[model samples]
Target: MKSAHQRFAGRYRPPSPKRSPLITPEGAAALKKELENLWRNQRPVITQAVSEAAALGDRSENAEYIYGKKMLREIDSRILYLQRRLDLIKVVDGLPADPNKVYFGAWVTLIDDDDNERHYRIVGADELNPSAGCISIDSPLALALIGKQLDDRVELNDLDRGYDIIAINYVNATST
Candidate 1:
């Protein structure tokens, strides 16, 4: 039997669709580093603060104790999520078989009908940073660009917006 709270929680939030399990090597490394920082540094510091605060007086009124516990809970939740994500993800490294055509890790240059040029890299979801022009492979634009050759015109699923692939290059991260 489900409790009322459990029923309400389940009703309010539908389960999300499964995300792609691919991640770039750099993105995987970043996730691992974050997990290490949280476990080795932040968790220990918060645990110590909570213990000290609890020793001072009644924890019911101890603001420091309450806050420290909350911080610890947040950090632990993040650590668990990172661990699960890292376990599920497969890191994609090295260049694609066809460097001239767009694939994962390829930097694509596109020209809109207006002749405005834009550059985007199709990376795994974990590596997406829109400000840096790194787009997720699952994104509509990236999906549209996949396997397309240079000068190939792409019509997106969205209404009427299309782009011409001007260039495709797989820039090795180690290369200048």
Candidate 2:
């Protein structure tokens, strides 16, 4: 007969890929703000709720206690992750030596073959938001744009697409 532990062995999972440690100053600040809110505001409220629920006894059957404990665990996990990531991340601030060339935190404007203009800000993975036109520096498109100057043509062989760099700026602006 197979033992319970042997019968229900955990599934093997591959480790996640390593993310770049680079972040924009804004991104770092946002992360710090989130950590602060979780630690100083949310956690205490949840802790107090859990304490009150525990005082009612019969914790095993108390829904409030169970839910509160789960929330606390989730908050703690996020706090730990933020702390570790913050420790290793490098915040990129200020303009690059050549503001005309694409670099981390640069807002790049590209014109496709169809004459459609697209704007994107190259930022760290933590700050990527497609709707906001922010792309990760480690992304393929950002990789192709890095070190490229205005009016330069970029070809992505893998995607079979090409774009022309219309503008590159260190500041956030819509117009070229």
Candidate 3:
């Protein structure tokens, strides 16, 4: 029953999400809102629905009961996950005072040698998504970018794909 991902360890646990020790005022508020919304709004709604469905009887044939219970379990699981995550969390919502240097939460625009441009927001692992223009702080590119100034150049390499040296053109807070 072990999937390939789990074959090595019986399950895959993504590394713990990375976050800066401090949060921007905005990031902090958002995380708080998220925790509240999940625990308060979502948790109770799912719980009540599951209880009502369970009362309908014929448990084996009850689609509503099955689905509702599953949903409830997911909600409770996420609530527990968030509780643990938040306890370990350090939100970095504020931009570093030195806008010239790349730091956690910096939005950077890079010009690759091939003349292609890419925009990235360096963020904590929990907040990073390629489609959202965010990258994890611990990623190779972000690691190289950190503490670098605007106009600095850096390279990223993969054994199979060669490497890229991009010049940093801009650095700012992505919040705006």
Highest TM-score: which candidate?
2
Clashes of 2: 0
User: For each candidate, what is the lDDT?
Assistant: 0.88, 0.92, 0.70
lDDT of 3 by residue, 23-133 (tens): 334555666788799788987887787788888888889988888788877877877876776677676644467767888777777877667778787766656579977
- Which prediction has more favorable lDDT, 2 or 3? 2
lDDT of 3 at 152: 72
Query: Which 10-residue window in model 1 sums to the lowest lDDT?
Result: 167-176
Q: Give the residue spans of candidate 2 off by over 4 A.
A: 1-11, 174-176
Give the per-residue lDDT digits (tens) of candidate 2, residues 5-26.
7776766466877888999988
Q: What clash count goes with each model?
A: 0, 0, 8
- Select the stronger candidate by TM-score from 1 and 3: 1
Worst 10 residues of 2 by lDDT: 167-176
Ranking by lDDT: 2, 1, 3
lDDT winner: 2
Candidate 2 residue 145 Cα shift, in angstroms, is 1.0
- After TM-score superposition, the amount by which residue 4's alpha carbon in candidate 3 deviates from its true location, in angstroms, is 17
lDDT of 3: 0.70
